[model samples]
Target: MSTPSYHPAAVALQAVLALANETEREVADRLGLNLTDYRALSTLSQSGPMTVGNLAVKLGATAATTTAIVSRLQSRGYAERLRGEGDRRHVHVSATAAASRDIMNLMRPLMDATNRHLESLPAAQQDAVAGFLHTARHLMQNHLNTLSTKDTA
Candidate 1:
């Protein structure tokens, strides 16, 4: 059998993913958080305050596991749970100001590195990269949803 042709785009995508994973690991270590904890905090930072059930769904974690994650964050003073006034059962988890600051500090280096690379690109190339990433994210989300449904079945 002949060797398959190598695609530069495919190789670049793989390298980008590997670098991102390494960045995540570095940030998590700097913040003294496990990968799951860091991911939960990252999600909370992006999505703002959300109920535990909603967070669990987002994290693909069970209710018990989510609760434990929340508890850990709460104990570390990184997060807090707010109970609704009218509906006490409605609990929402939010990152504390300190947690947000810490996360930002931990991520600043990676963000700066990525920004430097992006800034070096021409405007048109930057736009093209952004569009490609947006489409890639959407496609990944669709694939994940399909796999999730299959696993549940």
Candidate 2:
């Protein structure tokens, strides 16, 4: 067997992702939500109201599963389904005000601390960090696209 070498940046990125997942888990726990529900609520809050189908796609969940998730959210007073004004059959899922408030309250401390850390860096270092993260996000999206294409093909 051959040993495989890993890049330091790749290792660091993996650590960052693990930390993010842990944070998300803690947030979800405090909200009395499962991870999926927390993620769905977060998506709705950030993206505004969207069709259940669109939300399913974003969440990489089946339509039926998405409907169930929405139901759970609605029951918890974290989300609601709204009918389109013009189309009676069309419905959108939205995060309730309470969901946004609770999620923000849970996250504000972390957000403030992260912002402070970024602000403490020199301007050039701040820009460099921002640029690195932006590029990394783009690269990850591209990789996801490639994998999706391969799966479909």
Candidate 3:
């Protein structure tokens, strides 16, 4: 077989994703959380309160699994469950203030480091990087939507 050529952009993108995943895993470890719990915490922190079904969608977990995760978080005092006003059966999960603070403390250093690195780049390069990330995010979201639709079908 002939040797295959690799695109620089593809390699760089893969490296970036791998680095991000590794960093997240390290942060999760430092927080004494598994990857799934960490991801659920992240979603709650970013999205405020959401129903279990919504959180399940966000976490790509089933309702039963998300409930167990929420239970664990509640036991740890990291999350709270709120009952809906009109419908007592409807429940929403939110990250507690302590959880938010802890997550911020854990992530601030990484955010600052990334910001410093971005600052070292030229303004034009920084803008290009931002644009590329925005585009990549949208493309990935579209692909995820397609996959979800296919799964449902």
Per-model TM against the reference: 0.87, 0.90, 0.85
The C-alpha stretches of model 1 lying farther than 4 A from their native spots are 1-6
Question: Which candidate tops TM-score?
Answer: 2
The lowest-lDDT stretch of 10 consecutive residues in candidate 1 is: 5-14
lDDT of 2 by residue, 70-134 (tens): 99999999999999999989999999998999999989998999999999999999999999999
lDDT of each: 0.90, 0.95, 0.92
Alpha carbon lDDT at 118, candidate 2: 100
The digit string of per-residue lDDT tens for model 1 on 1-153 reads 998887887678779889889988888888889999989988888789999999999999998999999999899888899998899988999988898998898778878998999999999999999998999789878988999999999
- Model 3, residue pairs in steric clash: none
C-alpha lDDT (0 to 100) for residue 56 of candidate 2: 97
lDDT-based ranking, best first?
2, 3, 1
Top candidate by lDDT: 2
The better candidate by lDDT, 2 or 3, is 2
